[model samples]
Target: MAETQKEILVRYLQSAREALLWKLDGLGEYDVRRPITPTGTNLLGLVKHVASVELGYFVSCFGRELPVPLPWLEDDAEINADMWATPDESREDIVGLYHLSWEASGRTFDELELESEGEVPWWRPGQRTVTLQQLLVHMIAETNRHAGHADIVRETIDGAAGLRAGVSNLPDEGFDWPSYVDRVESAARTFRASDG
Candidate 1:
């Protein structure tokens, strides 16, 4: 049977969400919280960031607000609050908040049609207005982009790489990691030589 547009979009959105969350699996709290990059991108924090984005784009845009306090969205809040969880905030706290936000956003998807009207006040004038469909696509793009970041960050942490667990989205084809790295590095050196 043919699926509805909303169903298709929801499936993709959930897949990206799952991919981001999977990066945190089998890791300790400290590992999940620890900053893996100079930019301080951590597994738990990525979950936090996406939760905030989901609420903002889905609930807040539709002239509604999540019934929760998000101080990070405030003008006076410290920088990067949305990007990293503080010591006081437990891993479960942020992850639960994210799932709750998903529920609220999912409700929005259920209650409104794709063409339902919404406003993005932060966007520059003349482009604030948007439809539910547009927001859905926007989130898929944003979340998947972050999922890719999560993938690389996860790989950097423990060599776990894929679209999700048990799914090898990469082409290994029996090539070893060291051999693959050598080939890739040699190609880069060749390119550099050709440029110079």
Candidate 2:
């Protein structure tokens, strides 16, 4: 059976969401909240940022009001709340809010046709209008890029490497773990010696 354009977009968006969520798997509050970079890229913060962006594009951009008022907004202030999570924000709360945002966004996406246009009031006048399809593509790409960062951050936290939960399905089951580490260390030393 041929899938509709909406189906494909939804699938991709869902995949990216799953990948992002997967990064939080088997991780504790300390790990999820720990800043991995100078910019404070934490798992919970990433989830919160995505939720804010998705709500803006899929809901607010389409003239659909958000259920809750955005906390970062202030009088005559252009605070970009989507950049990071606040200290008081708990891991569960952010993740739950993100899931809710996904549902709200998904509902909007499902109801709108690919050609249905909406004006982003925040954008330049002529460039404000966009189709649901465009937003879907943009969100998918944006989410995946963050997911890549999540993958690296998660791996660095605990040596857990893979696209999703569990060990990656590698065919090299016969390889010894200790020997693999030794070989990698040997290669590093050899490279350093060559440089010196």
Candidate 3:
């Protein structure tokens, strides 16, 4: 049977989620939690942030309370609290919350028609209203964007880059990446000024 629109949306959303999570696999705790970018992006933190936003969009925006407690999202929480896992927050804790968010989001998907309308509390007054379909697309984009970040962060950590396990989706396995980088850099250098 042909797949439904909802199924297609869910499939893409799940794919992005899996890709983001896979970036953390086989890494030690410090590696997963440590900020990779100067702006402080990390693997476990991305998972936590995604999970928090998922619950907000799928659950709370639809007139339902969050199924899990996210103290990081509370009014008094520190700025960017959702962007990094604290030392006390175990890898399992963040990943577990993300798993729970999948369940909560799944229920929302199962219970609501794509046209069902909801309000985003944090959005501007006139623009807070949205349909489930719009939110699905928005979330797919959101998750995939962060998944891309995870791809770079993971690569920086240990040179692992791919859509998922056993699927590099890159050039030939033995391709010379160093030579490729040199050629690209040399091309850019052709436009450089002669000044020291």
The candidate maximizing TM-score is 3
Score candidate 1 by lDDT.
0.90
Candidates in order have lDDT scores of 0.90, 0.82, 0.94
Indicate the residue-level lDDT of 115 in model 1.
Answer: 96
- TM-score, candidate number 1: 0.95
lDDT of 3 at 191: 75
Where model 1 places Cα greater than 4 Å from the true spot, the runs are 172-174, 193-196
lDDT of 1 by residue, 115-189 (tens): 998999899999999999999999999999988988888888888888887897888667587888999998899
- For all the candidates, what are their Cα RMSDs to the real structure? 1.5, 3.4, 1.5
Judge candidate 3 against the unseen true structure and give its global Cα lDDT, from 0 to 1: 0.94
Q: How big is the positional error of residue 9 in model 1, measured in Å on the Cα after superposition?
A: 0.6
Ranking by TM-score: 3, 1, 2
lDDT of 2 by residue, 128-180 (tens): 99999888898999899998888888878997767665556443556687888
Query: Candidates 2 and 3: which is better by TM-score?
Result: 3
